[model samples]
Target: MYFILFLVCAALTIIGSLFRLNNLKEIKQPQGNFIGQISLDFEEIIVRTSVKEQIKIRDIKNIDINIRSIKGQYDGYSTSKFYYENGLSNGTENFIIMVLNNGIIKKYQFEYIPEISFLLNQKLIEHYYKIGIMDYLNCVDILGLDKREDWEKFKKLRT
Candidate 1:
């Protein structure tokens, strides 16, 4: 009975590892406003939207991940405005990617998937180093506390 249980556990471990390895290759969102997929392979990163787009790994200038929150309130009238803030709140988490392509900056927004984001970021950083691009990865927090005093207060509160 002990030997049989050990065999079962070993098989489960192999299956779990295989699943994780396959998941690292591609991430897909089949239904949403951004109904597409992002895949990483040897040569390039492919983004499939209504139209398919391919970006060669070597041509990539920089990959930036932006995290921000936007809150909207109605003034008891016909006007509703979204206020962008610098820190996380009870609102939804937004993930924004700013990519520089052919001298133009293109922005893409998607719902945050923490695991997929972290994996993709790690893969990109690895590839960037292989291709001799050192400073290509960046993370930006878009909550608008640009003032030095405000940033200091925010840091203190967080600690």
Candidate 2:
């Protein structure tokens, strides 16, 4: 029947069109921003203005920013700040300052803000940064720090 033949042709045409569109989409590559200073890559953030009903969802409402600068050995402090978003998450902003040292990261303060009010555990930060090194290491443990890497055979990067 001519009608059956036409229907078959129509179905095949629709399927072929969808297949072509999908193939084109697959060929497209995703894009993202590269943080040159640090080894971080993130996708471009876009805002969609949708006036939908507000639901009680728990999520990170603040953004934490930290900066550290050191001049010499055994010196330097870190400053941090917290900021809030007024509108939908959109666009990207970044600021960077020189960090002299990042010896130990004990507690990553979520929504951290640099201020007199910003509270941090001084003792915990100090211990996490240095105490672990001495507490659990012998001469064999620090061999990798050696310039010659005397234990190259012993420690093969674990990777």
Candidate 3:
């Protein structure tokens, strides 16, 4: 009975080791976003989903937003942003990309991933505040958010 128990424990240990190895392999080599992959690295962040949706951006780009009309779909404007890497496409089919200094936030809609959106928004608010109004507005201007209230709200959110 002791021998049988020892064999069972050994088998379990081997199985556990195999499982750990599989997990490590996954971490080392990401399989892409179609399987819903979200990777954050030191220099870049990538978000992808199966439905031909993806967003990849470098850390240096900082926060940016773009508003444009969706073709034959919405009566309102849709945001077009983000720089895709590795041949990934940020098609206008409900995919939105928002890039920032530390990372990028891309999704079908801000409501789709509230947690990620909140985190990115917080980061943008902090970054804008840290750089002061003139510089921040310069960024906002580039993104076409020229309204004074938009800038004011951004500053207010810092508190």
Q: What TM-score, over all chains together, does every model reach?
A: 0.40, 0.18, 0.26
**What is the C-alpha lDDT profile of model 3 across 1-159, one tens digit per residue?**
999999998998787655544443221212334345444333344555554432333333443333232223222212112211222212223333455445544343312232243234445434544544224654454334567887787657546
Off by over 4 Å in 2: 28-159
Alpha carbon lDDT of residue 26, candidate 1? 34
Best model per lDDT: 1
Clashing pairs in 3: 62-100
Backbone clash pairs for candidate 1 read 85-143, 86-143, 86-144
RMSD of candidate 2 to the true fold? 20.2
Over the stretch 33-66, how does candidate 1's per-residue lDDT look in tens digits?
A: 5577666555676778899988776666655545
Error of 2 at 86 (Å): 41
Q: What is candidate 2's CA lDDT for residue 7? A: 100
Once superposed on the true structure, which residue ranges of model 1 sit more than 4 Å away at CA? 1-32, 40-42, 69-101, 118-123, 129-159
**What does the lDDT read for residue 105 in candidate 3?**
44
Against the true structure, what is every candidate's RMSD?
Answer: 19.0, 20.2, 18.0
The order by descending lDDT is: 1, 3, 2
